[model samples]
Every structure is written in structure tokens, then in C-alpha cells.
Target: MATRRDPITWFDALNVVLLTMVAAACVIPMIHVTALSFSSEGAILSGRVSLLPVGFQLQGYRTVLESAAMMRALGFTVYLTILGTSVNVMITALGAYPLAKPDLVGRRLIWLLILFTMFFSGGLIPIFMVVRALGLLDTVWALILPGMIATFNLILMKTYFSGIPTSLAESARMDGASEIGILMRIILPLSTPIIATLTLFYGVGHWNQFFLALIYIQDPDKYTLQLRLQQLITDGIGYGPTVVFGQADDIPVESVKAGAIMFATAPVLIAFPFLQRHFVKGALIGSLKE
Candidate 1:
């Protein structure tokens, strides 16, 4: 008798099809944009470029790198991302430590207040006013301070810390270690996964900053990478007048816009792989634990 072959499951087949479609949806656009950015302007205008570059050239990258404004914006964004992510991680780690402890006084009220902010805010005008009142407007601090510790990440960190054994902290205190010492030596060492995850979160947010820079900053030199890229895309495509005139006209507008996107997205993409293991491990730390 001939052996019977196993039939393919319907759900498995459906899942494969769905996931492949989703992957293509994301990857195809990026590949298309990259190809367009490298292709000649005539090829782009004629719709000859797709996943492959037609008449490949580095003109778009050259245009982007050569512009003083673009370089300035890129530098500002790098500074902002580094400083802002540092502040975010430090503040969040410090804040979450005490909140995670069950014996801490007034913890519930503090947590409640933090949670409340997640659902409600003082509105954009009030926030802008506060930034202005504090003399943070048009400065690097304006980009960093207003969003210092995202509530969701705070709660996530707190929950992760809560899952740790309280006996560890108690033992550290018995060993003559101070609270900061325990955090530095004991808690943080074990909390690497969550820390890496939060760093990635904060870094990506700071890198993509735009609306805050738009509202608070008046100097063109102060613009972040995303804001400058936005200006390029909009102005180049004639959404409105170019913010920096005469500079964009010489380059192929579409190519430059695509190049700017790839430039902005590359760092995050490169950083993510190193931290992927931690991110995955940390993501599930607090779900089932009461």
C-alpha cells in the first residue's frame, strides 16, 4: 500500500499567505523608494523605476549631503536623540524603581496620577505655554523635556521591576548597600532586557521628532532631521513654497526626498538588530504577574 500524504492545514496556508502579503506590503515600498532615490530624474519622472534603479547615480545622496541646511538639521537631530534618550532612560529607571516596591508609601496615588496623564493632558497650547514659560522654547531642552518619561514605558518598567524578588532588595539593604547602590549593582544588572527595550523606544521617538521642533523652534538651523525632511518633501513636491529656496531646484526633488527618508531611517534599522533579543525578552516580562 502507498503511504498517504498529509494534507496542508487551511489555517496554516492562510497564515502563510497573509504574512507574506504583509511583509511585501512593507518591504516593497522601501525597495521602490530606494530604487527611485538612486535612479536618474528622467527615469523617475517617466515611471521607469521600481524595485530596481534605472540609470543608477548618486546624485540624490550628493545633493542631500552637500546642502549645509540638511547637514545642520542632521547634526541637531543626532544631538537631540542622544541627549533626549539618555534623559528618558535615566528618569524612567529612577522613577520606576520606587513605584515597583510594595512597601513604598503613597505609591498608588503616584501611579494613579501618572496613569491619569495617559488619558488626559493639559492640551497643546498649555504645553507650548509651559515650554515657553520655562525658557525652553527654541532650545534643545524643548525637544527633550516635554516628553521626558512616557507613561506606558514607566508603567511597563515598574511592572517588570515588580516581578523581581523583593528579597533581592532586602538582602542588598542588609549587606550595607544604599538604594542607589542596589539599583546600580543589583536591580539594573537584572533589568537589562527592559532597559534596552526602553532605550530603543526613546531613541526612536527622539529621532523622529518633528511637531515639537516645528512649534517651538524658529531657527532653520535648529530643525531636526525629520522636520527638514518634511520640509524637503512638501516643498519639493510643491505642497507649498520651499523653506530654503534655490537649493532644492537643482536636485531631482523626488530622489532627494527618498534619500532623506533612507538617511533618517537607517540608524534606527541598524541599531534595532543588536537590541532585538532584549526587546523580545522584555516585552513579555510583566503580562501574567499580578
Candidate 2:
């Protein structure tokens, strides 16, 4: 039987107040940015806009969307996110499944070696040289391949896979199911929560890839959205050089920057909800034992 709970105490009230403030701290900046994006040039420049738009306008969004470079960057980012996330999920799952098997020989050494990578790397120069040697420079593969299998995600996946009942795997083997068959038909079906969670993780990582593109991709056409936005922010003073008006001096750089941020951020925010239902469960289960 369930026990009766005591009524909320002063401590509970204090906790609520503290949590609400923290929530506001996070959400308020986004609200301000959204409001700034819609606010008129004069209102933004005058520093009058706050949580709400003053003298609403769509100029910042219009400028960002109208640029051919921005459009190309958006398209490239979408492609990179989709392709990179797919590769990450596939490779991580494949690698993790084998590692999760208790009977697998030399698993500890393999795990240790992989874990070592998380703490140390050969540095940027060596990585760049390797990418250059592979002829991946200035290519989409340059963005997707270098850091494909994140060690953290791999560890999480292996932990998740290990939690599945060993009996289920044994039963499949007894029924003559191949290892691949067991993974595809048995393990994966039971692994939806972790899969969805990791997909979201990988998707967001690829969507936000900037430094990789900045280093390896020289062609303007291959610039990811974040990298292009950085260029716009630096070169255009946030508002493009061509933004025409008598009140041109009144235009706020913050508004243009916010609009660009929103443009780059929208897809991830939208994609998040589909995977959110599984995120908490996945994180808890994966982290608890390993």
C-alpha cells in the first residue's frame, strides 16, 4: 500500500521559488532574443525592447532568408545533420552491440582503448593533416567523418545494450538466430528509447557543427549554417551592409544576430519534441549501471 505524504513545507516552497528563478534565467534570454528579432530597428537601437517586441517588423528574418548563401548553408547543414546522425547511430550501435556481450574476448582492453580517446587526442594539427591526406578537405565528408563516433555516446550505447536480458539473446541463439538477426530483430526493437535519445544527441551535434567546417571546408558553398552565421555576424555588423533606410544607423546588430540564431536553432527545437519522450528514460537507464 502507498503511504500518505505530508503537505508541502517551507523548504518545498523555497525550492519551488529557486527552480522557477532558474527556469526564468534560461527562458528569459530566449524570449528577449525572439522579441529583439521582431522589433523594429529604432526600437532595438534605442534599447527599448525587452521580453516583448516594440514596433514589430520582419526585416531581420527577411534579410537572412533572402540571402543565397544563407539558403545554401541551411541546406548543407540539414544534409550534414541527417547524414552525420545516421552514420553516428549506425556505427555506434554496431560497435556497442559487440562490446556489450559479456562473452566477447578482450572487451575490457577494447573498452579501455576507446575510453582513453575521451581523455586525450593527437591535437588539431595531426587531425587536420589526416583529413587533408584523405582528400576530404573542402568536402562534406570532412565535416561528417572526423569525429563521427563520439566516445561518450558509444559508452552510453554499450551500457544500454548491456541492460537487455542475456536470456533473450541466448534464446535467439538457440533458435539459430544469427548475431545480426538478434541485434536487428530483438535488441533494436527493445532499444527504442536509447536509440531515439542518441539520435537526438547526434542530430543536434551535427546541426551545430561549426569549428569543423571552419577548419576543413574552405569553399563558401560548403559552409555550415553556424559558420556562415559567424561570417555574417563578423562581416555585416549583424545587419547586412545592403540594409537600406534613412534609419539605417538605428538598426540593431543584436536583432540581426538573434534572427540568424533563431534560423539556425528552429530545426533542432522542432526535432527535439519527437525524441523528448524517450530522453529521460534513456539517460537514466544508460547512466545508472555504467
Name the lDDT of candidate 1: 0.85
lDDT of 2 by residue, 99-124 (tens): 99997999989989998998999999
TM-score for each of the candidates? 0.92, 0.90
Tens-place lDDT per residue, model 1, 230-249, is 87776445642246334445
- Cα lDDT, all candidates: 0.85, 0.83
The pairs that clash in candidate 2 are: none
The Cα error of candidate 2 at residue 75, in Å, is 0.5
Where model 1 places Cα greater than 4 Å from the true spot, the runs are: 1-7, 235-246, 286-290
CA RMSD of each candidate after superposition: 3.5, 3.5
